[model samples]
Target chain A: MLELQGIAVSPGVAIGKVLILDREGYRITRSQIDSADRHNELDRLRTAIAEASKRLEQHRRDSTEKIGVDIGAIFSAHQQLLLDTTLHREWERLISDSCYSAEFAVSTVLSRYAHAFRNMGSDVMAERAGDIRDVERTLLEALGGAPLQVSGGLGQSILLSHDLTPAETAGLDRSKIIGFCTEAGGPGGHTAIVARGMELPAVVGLGSFLHRIARETTVILDGFSGRVVLQPDEAALKDYRQRMEVRAGRVKQLTEIRDLPAVTQDGTRVTLLANIEFPGEIAASLQRGAEGIGLYRTEFLYLGADTEPSEEEQTTAYREVLSQVDGLSVIMRTLDLGADKVGKFTLLEPESNPSLGLRSIRLSLRQPRMLRTQLRAMVRAACGGKLKIMFPMISTLHELRTARMLLRQVIDELAEEGHQPPQKIQVGMMVEVPAAVLMLERFVREVDFISIGTNDLIQYTMAADRSNEYVADLYAGHDPAVLRLLQTSVDVAQAAGVEISVCGEMSSNPITSLLLVGLGVRILSASPASLPQMKQALRQVRLEDCTQIAKRVFDFDTAREVDAYLKTRFAELLPEMALGV
Target chain B: MGIHMRPADLLSRTAGRFECQVLIENNGQSIDCKSIMSILTLGARQGTQLNLRVTGPDAQQALDALCELFEQGFDESDSEVATEQTS
Candidate 1:
């Protein structure tokens, strides 16, 4: 029995036969079309396309019922690509000209398309090829019998894959699969998102186990810690058993707090909002008691579309969300595309450091017509809804002013078109850029409110890429620069008589939220999954000497110092751990 | 006929590769189903078909949307999305 310890990202346990998802590179090599018969090969390719389309349509049917129309559109778009004439023509040309096998042609083209993207280019364009390849490979796998067959009736097996691609993970039967452990993948990988969505227990980047842990080795996965123990000893068994009991108790406690208001023990009213990427998560957010959507990312609208969404389509999306979460404030950030959302979409330019490029309001201002169109759509949708507009990555008052000018232009257009627009739409900026936080005093006067986007702020502050496993040690959320920024943003906002809050990961962290509220943040936005715990944590403490603590933290240099401080403070404040008990 | 070019261009034009007559109306709205800028903003991609049931003002644009798919092959650019779209 082998025992291994790694980071457990998702939480769950499964003991079953290991079904390894194969690497696309090797599979492509094996399935290279080798026949000299051209006509027969064409026929084979066509049949495969038909099968892929049929399966995609079926997936659309199944998921549409579960997720809804937008997700359905994603599958439908894949099906449409299957009938793409250019793709077929390319395949024919490759077969005729290069004389390579069919599978080889697909593998080559898709791989070329997939790798064509520079991780630091225009996010929309950078992602275009991958999205295209994703579509291509989905079709190719159907043709080659590579992906679909891998999923056939393994019956609730714990997926052991060399590396599970996004498509394979999405294709997984979440009901049967208790968890997944992969040799390759990271947090930002699509596999991670799919697993998170499916709520499956997953631990990734576990080097070579297909040979070491033979089939059905009865492995256990700890998603919370990224730990995998094979054939545990008596002590390990007792530890996990006791851990399970604690988890169950925590679950019960959290569930009870889900329906409770996220208020501090001192009766200070703080609004809990959901920061989400898709409209699909809204239902879960509302179900979990989110006052409304703090950050409604517009990327998904662009991400899954075979084409850009029409103004009408954009309107429909905005309206649907507003109507569903009626009476709650919906803060909309326009096109927060930059270093992370790399793709080629024609309007955005490719940049070296996209993190500091013409993103957010900068991109929108460059494409005034596009920005105006989105704003018009959003404004038109806000006939009587509680909607506010937010500009991300704003570094100066000039950017904020320009973004608002465009907002006014959109409003004027709507008014000129005789549409009854909202009486007022509050303007806000995400204090995501360190420069923005530094300029909060000046910015607070210009915007009605502020949201601390801790993700980028931390990255920019520490100059660390949270996605890099090697540098993750430096990407601590509690680092002094990050905490100082949070504290300053809150203080600046309060002094300006403007509302300030953090809608970042720190806000969702049950422990960090203590520090956040301690710094005067009244609006906390985080993923809905973290809401219950945040609520439970908030109920544990009243206002204390946050000024002194913030001062101490700001003076500290490392995350370890901040973490140690928090641990000691938390242990002191809640000795029983009763809130999350 | 569609010209085969790099799709990674943020401004690849698509004016000729679509069905000029078949306008698939996007339910009660005026939309150019084919403009590259239109496609980009709408977030269209390789497999996203432009069914041009669009008529009236932007009918020709609808055809452009379909043909754009044929004209531009995929290219990589750098612009990471900070957040995904939520409903």
Candidate 2:
């Protein structure tokens, strides 16, 4: 049995076969086939090649009809390349002689051809490598390999990979993927946030373990202990199974307190809400006793689809979530694309530094029609109800004002079209950029509410990318500057009488949730899975003690010092909560 | 800037018309002209010299058509002016 230890980013225990993924998140199955199956594998290769050729033929015709001969000819070339006689012979040779699996042989042959083309000392030849990859992916799909997206057709397995981008993590099929064990990612990475949001067991930063395990190897991932045991002995399996049951019992205990009020011991009530991606998750959020949906990230509607969702589709989805909440306010944040989530939806040129480039509000402002369609949907979905709209990654007041103006124009246009406009809808902006916080008073006056998205705020403030492990230590939520900014945002919002909340990953942590509560943040929005624990933590503490804890952390010089102080105080004040945390 | 011809298109349009075995030898590599992929791998840029070898019943006809096509630069228009912009 092989044992590896890494940082545990999510809680729970899972034992299942692992699906190995390459850096690009494509499933890599390279096991050797039995010698007897060589003929069948060869037949499989032939069948797949035929299937891919047919698909390319269809694409060629479609493109020729829709686009022109130039585009259609590209697909025709792909088809010819797929049917390349020499390539077919090479694949058959690999399968029959080397007894390699059809999948392995196909990837090997295509990769070899692509490599050869890349080194041919001509720019045009190197460009043909991309065509080879397209053919390779097409052939693989025809061979019944998992689709390129990693979100579909993936059976039950623990996903092991080098790392997962935020977009890939967000698109993970929770029903099929049991957990995540990445070779390189920090606890504060966006993958951790998504894993925690989905309540999947994950352990990251297991450096160089992808080379040790084969695909579909039964492994035990103990998220609580941050250990992954490969091919575990029966005793280890039994122990892990028992631990899983115990963790489940603990979750059951937490769920028992779900219906209870999220009120501090001193009679201070805080609104606890859920951050959800899909409208379907609203029921689960409500089951976990979320008072409302604090953050409804609308990017999922655009991410997995070929085209941007129509305004009517967005309206229907938004209306579904709002209707399910039953009068509770649903704060739907506009498309937060780019910066690890850009896909086919945005038409902006690829920037050198995407996080600082045209993303979120910047992209929305540049493409007003994109923003208008989304705003029009939100306006239509409002239907004079408690639907609050918020813009994400608002770095400047001008962007916010422009977005608000576009929203107003959308509302007026809808009204002119004889659509009844909503009576009232609260418009807000996320305080993610440091510039926004520096001008917090100016912002609060122009909006009805503001939520602190600490993920981006901490990333932007420290100049440390949350998704980058090398800078993970620098992306500290406990940094004096970050804490000060949080306090300032809260103070500004409170003085201006604008409803303030924190819907970042930091708020999902038990101690951080208390700190935000102590810093005068009355509403905390986290993943639905974390609501019960946050509720339990809030219920045990008095508002007076929380404020004291929040105040003392500000005096620390470094994040380590602040973290140590918070840990010691949390343990001393709430011993039971410390264990679960 | 030099003359440009879409090698894949050049091969796709003519390679299959002959029953002869067609080969284009460039830079000490002999590539099958019938395979668009092989023809592309030649990386035959502008001002590059290539040797054509054909052997079959229609070898002479194949050789004549191919040589004429190469001379005409596959009938490509304004290729030198187009100058395949390299990034």
Candidate 3:
């Protein structure tokens, strides 16, 4: 029996025969072409090139029809690479002049270009090496070489790969793919994001040991714990089977309440919303019964771009998202760039401590043009559907007022330009910093709503970076100090008659959601996948019970004590909930 | 075909076309136009003149299309919004 530990990107337990997708770095043998067969060898090269081009064009069309035009452009580039006269001539020359075989010639020429791309000294350029390699493999397959494609059939085994690109992940056959593990990729990567959206169990960053695991090996993947056990003993297999059954039961229970309202037994209706970064996620969120989009992270538009997106570009994107969401309100967070999430377009000096450095609202305030451009697009997109603009990392009232002022200015400017201003839109602030929580009373009166960004709030309150494993233990939302702040903000917002939502990781946790509801937080925003589970857990507990639980939780001194108390309490109250939490 | 452009900008506009190799040589730097990474390494900017060389079955057609693209200044009409969602 062998075990591998990795970062769990998605939650679930999957057991299947391993199907290793060893596509990268496939070996190609070099050989001399016989003089008698040189003409046939050249013909083989031409046929291979044409076949690869046809396949790429078909993939491009399929991608356009299934996903969108932008992704189809990737395959279009591949097609262009196939038709590149320079590359074609290089291969032809190797066959005619160097007397190299077609497959060897193609491999050698493509790898030379791939190496050139990799040695470009730019990260963006280096990434294109993967694309070159992808095209090379496709050409090799067309040349009667060993097939590099992953076969998809019903009930196929789990996929293990070095890494999966966005295109590869998108093309995944949902019916065949049981789950996937990769040696590289983070939780925020496109592969993990798609896995979460598809509700597929995935574990990434497993390191190189994963590559050594043979095909068809029986393995148990615990995505929740980010562990994969290979060739387990009978006792271990039995235990895993029981755990899987329990999880399946829990999932079945959650699915039963998928369409049900997130209300307690006492009829307190708490709104459950989804936090989405891309417009493609709206379908999944709505399918999972999200009331509305609570947080539409807009920073993604600016990140990974060579230049700043024009106002029209931004408007087109926002409008597409708004139009798709129907009439559901979308709280669009304006350009939350800085600290750990800096974009290429926005230039900021390197900081020793970026978490506390100039970022978010501060960065926006410093570069008002960037904020104005986004605000203009947002205001324009408001015509498509219900829109709510939010400013992130508001540490002080001054920053909030300044952001509000800039928003109003953009509205007025648009009006002057003969554009009709949005009739109704709510402006809000994210209560992420400690100062914002302390000044909750003042903040509640200023904005239409308040979103408690528990991720950053807990990190800042505990003086710990959540991403750093060394400080991860210190960064707990259930800590008395953090909980008190959350409670105070909820209390203040309730009193002020302003809508407040907990749009953070904590809102997804059953125990924390119970505590949030007990503390009078009426709205919770989390990933769409967690919505059903959150609703299921929320429906079982009465508001009175939650209130008592919260009261007892508050009495605890340390986060550990509070966590233990809640676990025991929930175990007694709801046994199924205790198992998952 | 005198306008200078970055590799990504050029690729975005023309990479969807037929599979034909294009080579651009300028100031002693020779690079593959089909490969965005190779083009980017050259870092050609405004006013940098490049000699185009095309070779393949569709070399003439590829050359004409590329020359026309360069002549038109790679100005993709704003009417068609290519929405590539980043996440």
Candidate 4:
């Protein structure tokens, strides 16, 4: 039995045979191919790539909306490269000129392209190699002329590999692919997105997983926590079965609550919105009945792109988002880039501490062009939509004033340029830095609304790095300090009579959400996937109950104590709520 | 020398390389360089360490980075956990 641990990109549990997508990488058999076989083999390779392309398109059609069109388009690109006459011609010439076999020439050309693609000095470019490698593999498979099946019969085992490409993933049969584990990928990667969309349990980024896990072994896949148990004991199997049934039931229940309004038993109605980083997630949020988009992270536009998007490019993206929400309010935060968000070439110098350095509003003020371009795009897109501009990492009143000044300046610029100004859209601040919380009253006066960015707020407030797993257990959202700030911020927002919402990782966390509600945050926004569950939990507890429980939770000394106390109180308070409660 | 790690173990051996007893993010196989914010995103606070032995093409460099982040010499003050929740 082989056991390995890795990040849990998607959540689920399954027991299925493995499907390894091992690229017999590119190989040269040290044999000279006759001139006759070279053309024939090249033709076969072309055919295989073409066939793979068609299958990818079909997979796109069959795939539910969760798996993005990008995945399909990636396959489509691989198809083009495989069938590219230039690449094929190069291979042909290399074979004849170098006196090498078809396999040798193909391998040489493929490796050269792969290496060049990987050395592009960007993560996005490096990732493109994954798709290119798959194309090379497909061509190789065609030379064998045996129908390669990634997934087949029930007893037939996994197609385990170092990694699975978009093409390889599209080719796998749903029924036979009980679960897939990879030695590479992350929660944010395309594979996890595909797995979530396909309702498949996947444990990815487990290095050398194929070398460890045997073929055809009845392995238990725990996608919930990204665990693969091989040849499990009876007790383990039973536990997994029960867990599976519960998950299926939970999903069915959550789906049922899709269109249901998030109302409390006591008749208090609250808006549950989605905090989205991309335009693609908008549909999923609407499907889950999110009242609006509370947080449309604009940072993504600046990140991973070849260059800072032009004002036109930013406008196009912003307009697409505003148009899609369909009358729902989209509270868009301006570009919150810093040392972490800058493109590789743009990084001037590495800082000893980036989070503490000039970032967010600070960085934006430093690089006014990037910020202005985004603001112009946002303001332009705000026409005929309930859009608001939010500033992230606002610490002092001067920062807020400067941001507001820029907004007014932009509005005047639009008026001068003969452009009809968009809505006098609401302005907001992300209460992340502790100074922002301390000057809550001042900010309340300056901005239209508030959304507590708890992730940064917690890290900066606790003076602990949230990314350092070593100290992960130390950074507490429920700490007296965090609660003290939250309590004051929420109270200040209420006193000021501006609407307050929370859109952060903690907002999605059930315990934190409860405390937030108790602290007087009426609008709870998080990932749409967590909305139904949040709604169900919200329905079980009253504002008064939540407030009281939150008070108790904060008073606890350690996170362990707080977690334990909350769980016990939650069960006692909301018995028969959801099995989870 | 290659340090073993689960690709998904965000706060495992390599994850501990950041901030030692303090806190930091696990970038690729270890702490994210260029920006502490990237490490902050990892949300690692549980006191996880540089388990992989320091030796490789960039071993000394990696160790130097670790030492700098952890504030080498571990003065009780440097390694001190803020016992009280500061508001």
Candidate 5:
């Protein structure tokens, strides 16, 4: 058996036959067209364009219904590119003037644009090249070209491809396809993101060796460990089959308890919510039995667009999310764009140190109109269902008070416009900055609730940029200083009788969940996929046991000692809950 | 009409309903106006005069619309609102 290792993007296992989908060498050959047949060629090109546009429109509708509007927006952009007059005119001109075939002309023009985007040295621009190529392939296939055979009646197959665009992944037949592995794409690529949303077992960035595997080969794909074994022996296959059965049994056990509340054995109740970026994720969150949406990132509406979204547009989106949750509280964080996520409309000048530069609350306060527009939309949406507004990255009390003032102004204006104010509206702050942690008591009194954004809080506390691979070792969430800060904030919130929730990657981890429970944090929000596993872990430990664990953990000098102690304790008390550190 | 264009102006205007190639030439450098990256590379600030060239079946119509857009100063009214807010 040949073994390949890649980046594990989603967690699951699938043993199935392989379906190789190689679309690398579909190049257009330049051929001459007679002058008499030039009109026919243009007609073919127009028909092909019309067919491609129809297909893209259908894909956009399907993706919007299946995925979310943000993912569907990718297809919307593709449709816009297909309808671009410049691209259409360029290809038409090339076909008429150069006496080249329609396929050749289309391919040539698209390649030039794609190459230009590729050489631009920006990740956003580079991704556009993939979109251009996707459109080109669709048009070429419509021109009676080589069939880009990706779909068919395949039973229980793992799809292997060179790479997959977001549109392609969204359009896959999920019932027949068990898992997917790509020769390209990192953990952060759109393919991986969509795979996680679909809950499909996936591994990516395996390099070109994956193309060498023959079709219909029995392969074992372990997406959690990022291992793909081709032509597994009998013993290995049997072993994997047993492991799959175990996982299926575990999943069934978790689903049985999904409807039950996440309460400790000692009668202490804990709230488990889901962190979502798109409205499409509400179904999955509900299926996982999330009590509410802890963090709904609103920056997605502003990203990848040339113009700012209007208040009406933002209202429709927020209303859709609120309606989907069906009265479950949705804490919407307004437009956290900057640092690694600068959008087209929220462009800023290049900074040498963007992590410490103007971002989050700073950017929102600088553009008060933008902030006001979003707040108006949220207020309008709140009239329909439960909605809580939260300000992110508030380093000081001044920023919190200013943001609250703007929110109040929006509410008063909406009330004056004949719209009834929301009956129960809560405004909160994300306690991520170190300064915010120090003044948690004062901040808690002013806001309705507080959510600990541990990802940024840990990074800022350690003085390390987590995105920088060089200092990644320094950015540990288990650090004693970070835990102490978390404990302090939770203590302050509890004393003030305010609700506090931990919504970050730290709360998603099973071991860390125990420590957080011990620290007086009764609410934990994680990704929807991890909610079941987290609930299972929480149900296995009592609050008193967790408190004792936390006390011992706090006495440790370093993060390493705390992690080691927790790992050993969890393994002994709950072997099934042992997630390797 | 010769007109200067900013990055945002090019990004917003080039996606208009005209199936034609709009090329902008300045100081012997030329690139497609439809590409935001190309326009950004030009670094054309306010009042940097650019020569416009249209080539396609709808060249005349595209050129006319583009000239009208330029004559209106690439929709300066929106920028004026933003500037007013900041001031």
Candidate 6:
């Protein structure tokens, strides 16, 4: 048995025969063509372009119906390139002037443009290079080269490829393909997003391991652990089969407890909320038994589109979310656009260090008019629902006070405009920066509630960027320093009689959810998919036991030590939930 | 993220109907106006000034239609309004 480890982008398991999809480069020999055959060569190029255009349109229509219009538009872009009159003229020019064969002319012209796009220096424009190569591949296939057979041969197989584009990933035959693993892909790539959207088990960034495995080799892909085992022995196969059965059993077990409260064994009721981006996620959040949305990220309002969303448009979206949550608390965070997500809508000078630079609440304060428009929509949306406002990356009392002052202005403006604003709207701020944790007592006195954004808090505390694999090891949530910071925020918020919760990646895991409850966090928010297992984990443990675990973990100096202690205690205490974690 | 319109939307099919020889120039680089690849290669981001040159029997009509499209942000403004209408 050969075992390989990679980053898990989606969660599931599959054991099936391997179908290797080698996207090998096509070889185009520059053979000479006769001058008398120029007309025939031009006709051949035109026929190939027409065929490729037809196929691209079909893919566009198929993807538009399957995946949304945004992804479908990719094929439309490909179609546009296929039908480019200039491109055809360039191909004809190369064939007739240089006496080149039809395949040679097409490849030479398309590859030149593709190389130009690759050297364009902008990352966005560089991606167009891939689109150019995709068009070239289609035209070459129509010219009777190697064709990519997408369907008709596979049966319950796992796809192994060098890499897959978003278009190719979306076009996979779902009925026959069980899962997929790639030697090249990142967690946040569009292809990975498509994999997650299709709910496929996938492991990416495995480097190079495709050469050793052969077709029809029985392999096991574990998405949770990011392990792919090829040609497993009898014992290994039996073990994986048993684990799959356990996974199925766990899903059934979670469904039975979906309606149950996430209360500890000692009757400590913990509020389990979901972190959501769009209004459409509320139904799924409710289905997973989330008490409410703890973190309603509003960055999507300004991320993708060309222009800033108007007050009326923002009001409509906010109202839809408030109504969908059905009286549950919906805390709308103002635009947290900066850093990597600083799209075209929010205009800001490119800073050298965007993380510590103008971001989140800093950007909102710098552009208060933008904040006021959002605040106005939020105030208008708060007709009678339990709507709250939360500011992200709050580092000082002055920033929080200034933001609250803006909210007051919005409410007053609404009242003056003959709109009935809510009489008592709660306000909160994220205690993400280490400075906020240090002065938590002073900040808590001004806000109604505070939530610990562990993702940023850990990054700021560790001075490490988690996305940078070089420093990812340094960015740990279980570090003693991070625990002390969370301890400080929870203690200060409790003393000030303000609600304290954790709404970050750390709260998404069952093991960390228990640790937060032990550290005196009454509310916990994570992605909707993690709610059921977290509820199961919390239900299996006592408050006093969790408190003891936290007390012991705080004495450790290193994150590794804390992690080791927690893993042991988790297995000892929550044996029913031990297998998956 | 530049030129927010998708390639198909940016290179409107109306450009092909005209008999004019149209060219779009940016940063001293001119490309054929009827090609989506050319427009994408231009990399004309927001607030960029692109010179459109047209010459033929239908040059006037082509220039007017193309100018209006560029002024309207290549029909990208319509996406936001379309979403609001559906909602």
lDDT of 6 at B27: 73
Please, what is the TM-score per model? 0.65, 0.79, 0.63, 0.61, 0.64, 0.65
Clashing residue pairs in candidate 2 are none
C-alpha DockQ of every model: 0.02, 0.25, 0.06, 0.01, 0.04, 0.27
Which is the winner by DockQ between candidate 2 and candidate 6?
Answer: 6
Error of 2 at A113 (Å): 7.3
Error of 4 at A81 (Å): 29
lDDT of 2 by residue, A1-581 (tens): 89999888888788887777654245765435678888888988888989988999999899999999888878877887888777888888877887767776777677777888777656766777788888888888898777545446556888888778766777777788898898888876656876877788999988877656643468899887799998799999998888778768878998899889999999999999999887878888998999999999888788767788998899898889888998898999998888677767567675779889888888888888888999999999999569999999998889989999999899899999999879788999999999999999998889999999998999989999765666778988999989999999988899999999999988888899999999999899999988988988899999998999898997889999999999999898889878766
* Candidate 5 residue A304 C-alpha distance from true site, Å: 6.7
Find the candidate with the highest lDDT and give its number. Answer: 2
Better of 4 and 5 by TM-score: 5
Q: DockQ score of candidate 3? A: 0.06
Off by over 4 Å in 2: A5-10, A21-130, A138-155, A161-173, A183-194, A203-208, A224-226, B1-45, B48-87
Query: What is the TM-score (0 to 1) of chain A in model 1?
Result: 0.73
Candidate 3 lDDT over A369-414, as tens digits, reads 9999999999998985899999999999999999999998889999
Model 5 lDDT, residue A421, Cα: 82
DockQ-based class of model 2: acceptable
Model 4 - which docking category?
incorrect
Can you write out model 4's per-residue Cα lDDT over A155-178, one digit (the tens) per residue? 534334555554345445665666
**TM-score, cand. 6:** 0.65
Query: Candidate 4 — which residues are off by over 4 angstroms?
Result: A2-10, A14-226, A230-242, A339-345, A575-581, B1-87
Best by TM-score: 2
Q: After TM-score superposition, what is the CA distance of residue A241 in candidate 5 from its true location, in Å?
A: 4.4
